[model samples]
Target chain A: MPVFPRFTALAESLPPTVPFVGPEAQERTRGARFIARLGANESGFGPAPSVIEAMEQQAGLSWRYGDPENHDLRERLGAHLGLAPDRIVVGEGIDGLLGLIVRLIVEPGTPVVTSLGAYPTFNFHVAGFGGRLVGVPYRDDHEDLDGLLAAVKRENAPLVYLSNPDNPMGTWHSAAAISRFAAALPETTLLVLDEAYSETAPVSALPDIAALADMPNVLRFRTFSKAYGLAGQRIGYVFGNRETVSRFDRVRNHFGVNRLGQVAALAAIEDQAWLSHVIALVVASRDQIGDIVRGHGLKPLPSATNFVAIDCGGDGARARTIMDGLVSRGVFIRMPGVAPLNRCIRVSTGPEVEIDIFEQALVEVMAELNGL
Target chain B: MPVFPRFTALAESLPPTVPFVGPEAQERTRGARFIARLGANESGFGPAPSVIEAMEQQAGLSWRYGDPENHDLRERLGAHLGLAPDRIVVGEGIDGLLGLIVRLIVEPGTPVVTSLGAYPTFNFHVAGFGGRLVGVPYRDDHEDLDGLLAAVKRENAPLVYLSNPDNPMGTWHSAAAISRFAAALPETTLLVLDEAYSETAPVSALPDIAALADMPNVLRFRTFSKAYGLAGQRIGYVFGNRETVSRFDRVRNHFGVNRLGQVAALAAIEDQAWLSHVIALVVASRDQIGDIVRGHGLKPLPSATNFVAIDCGGDGARARTIMDGLVSRGVFIRMPGVAPLNRCIRVSTGPEVEIDIFEQALVEVMAELNGL
Candidate 1:
């Protein structure tokens, strides 16, 4: 069958691909469920009991469309963040919000800056909008702040993405260093500071809200998918200067955010105790993963996020072989897409049972690789 | 506070406004909630008990991110629609899907055609993408198929939108008429056939799936939001020739659909009995509305949708008075934005109790207007 031939050149140029192939897709292909789902950094610990109850209680109310403005949730989030509600815009997810931000700022040939192997979804959005990406390489497994700033300056890029407590490598910079980097950026540059893992990070790794609230060029993206454990809900928000944040309103599907997600996110916020419990479990899981990798003579990178990146003492090819072995054994995990970073396999902190599976799979995979 | 100055010219040109102000926003402003929510055409009858049960059952598993590929839901939908899975693409909602289709085809200065007063969300997306819209006015109360075809040919537009069993006016064309309209459109023009109200319409109002199945340029959009009563879940899908449907994958937020929504939609599809019940109730409610309007000396347009568009036998100002009076009396309702259509007020078919409130309120409002 012939495809409709009028899609814009930009749309036609984009490869029909997802940034990450979900574990569900893999299960269908493999014809078996993964014994461990540590690939997507989802909180396998599950949502709070209170949140589940709230969802159950309100599931019948799913007949009404969600409040297009996301009023109550935004009001609560405003109270939580110490900013006015206007400063925040709730969206389907951080990925969806990233796409909107890119659409607002990027035109064909527009320059965007980010770490070479940073969040692939952000890059996907930039490319979707026909933006030219200028990637700065990570230094020492950390998103190099100086390198990103230099590239922004060199390319005069309007948009730059920085994920503190970054993904893939599971690394972070102190809040002070991040604040310095934000302060050094040109006013013309819009910084997308993703803090999806903020709840799992040390308190000092996140900047004071006041430090960046005044800057129109910086929008911080956060979500309930990590420590709060509502990844399937698809609720994420972006906040900054009201003006910068309001740009989302112009193009967003006003009723796009699902109803139960708002209910779950609101309930999750009210259950801070549950979040603290999840964070504690995450810390223990991280330590357990560190020990497990060290026992196999691998180096585990210190992480502030909900996952650990363990160096396999080899290159990307070796990491791929180990990852493949684990996958064949029904253990799901991921690795960075680029060279040095790809040498490290990433595993999410989750329930001890799932982590046990990961540990067992890692041992057998390592033994098999040693034999080879 | 300073606004971010680096947004693209197109983004800067667009206004920050919602296509429709939700009843929740109005209630917030009014400092009171509407006792009867007949606006926005949401089913106050609510979702199926089975769907609610399914959501409750899966509430705890929300910790895992939704299947990014929407594999299972798409598979079930494909079976339901008698199409191959590759021909269907699910997204956040039909609204979200509409935005994606517009983005895929529309670019700066691209000419797009649609009914002048049809779904505002579609228009919002066109303007967001900097596409110039050529709106053909409605003929009588229904979308003018011939007028739209003329506009498409005149502008050499690459895209056109048609919502069967139309909104605001609650009128429709026969399936034969719609099929002919699709066949007549240029192959270069992609037709976004929104069937959001399909389940509520007469059997003859919808073309057989096979009627337009082979046309790459015809993509039919449907949702669980209306007769299925899953509006708040935000799940909608589009299907067409495999090659055409696949384009959505290139630009969509792969993980945008929520977890419970997928479950709810799956269960809703299984509960055909409940859907039949809702449709019967909607029919009764529509008749109830028609009677109520006629008793008040108003004209209710013949409807194939889950709403009644009642003409007040006056102009837009008179209709506004009646609508505002109903809202003030806590009976939420809406009207079309443009001319002759605006002479009518739209009320969604909902539960009998809400319709009771609407009837009482309309009686009082009309009496007051007459006295004035």
Candidate 2:
């Protein structure tokens, strides 16, 4: 049958596609679950028990919609970060918030800048809004700040995205470099500093909340999904200048955040001891992954994020083979999507058992694939 | 500090306002919790114990992102509705889904059609997309289908919203009338048939899925929040022509729905026994509320929804005073936002304890407001 007749021209012209095919989809296709799930970069150590307890306790309150203003969670987050509540806007997740920000700036043919393979979801949102994308390929396995800046200037891009302690390659630039990049951007360009992995990064790698707090052109995204292990809860927040964050209120699904997520996030925020313990576990797991990757004769990239990227001594096709091999063997890991970076496979930090399974599967799969 | 620069002119022009204020916000303002939580139309009876158990059991697995495609939930929902999986799209909630649909159709100054006092979130999304709204006021507290069709034709609206078993007024049109209305709308005007309250409604009020299934311009929205009692979980789905539903894939946050919400919704969908139990409670409570309204000398509108809207035998002003009196005395109820409809106070069905509290509060509140 013919589709709805009135989708906007941009929507009509767009193809039906998604940024990422989830592991669940793969499992369904394969008709079996992966023995070790490391593909999505989700925390395998799971949420703090206290946070779980809090969510379970309030499970009965599922009858109530979450606060439309998201008042208490925002107030608590504000107090925790030493920012005013007006400076923060909580959302379904960074994914949902990114869509909102893209809508706020991108009209038909508006230009947006980001690394070619930095975050496909962000790019998907830009395309969804009919924005023209200017993707600068990564330099030195890290986002090319200078290149992104040049592209933004040339295209007069209104939005640019950079993830600190970045994804896929799991490499990071120093906070100083990021701050300089933010300062160099034209006042008209908004930088979306996705700090989704900041909880596990070294303190020096992160800018203080106040360092970029006053920059209306810079908004940093954070999520409980990382070290807090509430990825499934779909809670994330972005805070910046009060005026910028306030604009989100104008268009957001006011009651979009669920009741359990609000409670889970609030409790997760309070359990700082658990966060610290999980960071320690993440650090240990990253080291263990590096050791295993090196043992396989692959060069493990230095990482401040929860995952380590191991150069596979080949191209994107070779890396895809390894990724597929791991999944077929019931060990799920991911790799970068573009060239240069795609020469590496990314393994996320997880509990010891899952990591051990990955370690065993990696050796066997590599041996079989290489005909060693 | 200056705010972010380069927001689209449309975005910059919007007011930073929310669609609805939650009862939690009211409690914070009053410095006391509502003794009777009847606002927001949430199922105060709460989700089934089995549903809560499922959530609690899955709490530890909150580390994984939900399937971006929401595969299992969609497949199960498709099976439940005897439709193909391609015709269903699960989302954060009905609200988020509506925002996506509006974005797909409405550009700046595009005309949209809705009832004068229909879902405010729908209006909010239309404005967010810079669409001009053409509203038809309710006729006798029910959506004026004739008027809506006239407005759509007059304005050449590309989109229209109609909520079956409607909110705020709790009135509904029969299936024949709704089908006629859908047939009357221009095919160019996509119709959003919101059945968010469908489960609580009488069968006579709902059009057969087969009747609207093949209509390219028609989409039906349903949620686990109402009869299934999973509001805090934030899971909702929309179904229509396969081509129409597929359009959501281009822009939806692939991973927007939460994992536990997926699990909870799946379990809720399977537990028809529990749904029947909740439906019974809602029916009894609705009747109880109707009796109370009659005893108080207020006229109760017949509701096909889970809430009862009682006309206070006065205008919006008197209804507002009565609503405020209830709020001041620790009752939480909402009145319609627009006039004519605003002449009534809406009360959501809840457990007997909450209903008793509402019954007691209404008598005292009315007496105090009328200076008895």
DockQ for every prediction shown: 0.89, 0.86
Model 1 clash pairs are none
The per-model lDDT (C-alpha) reads: 0.93, 0.90
Best by DockQ: 1
Error of 2 at A8 (Å): 0.5
Candidate 1 lDDT by residue in tens digits, B1-372: 777889999989998777999989999999999999999888999999989989999999999888988888889999998998988999988999999999999998999999978899999999999999998899988899999999999999999999999987889999999999999999999999999999999999999998898899999999999999999999999998888888999989988999899999999999999999999999999999999899989999999999999998889999999999999999999999988889999999999899999999988998899895
For A342-370, candidate 1 gives per-residue lDDT tens digits of 99899999899999998888889999999
Cα RMSD (Å) per model? 1.0, 1.1
**Docking level for model 2:** high
Docking class of 1: high
lDDT comparing candidate 1 with the true structure: 0.93
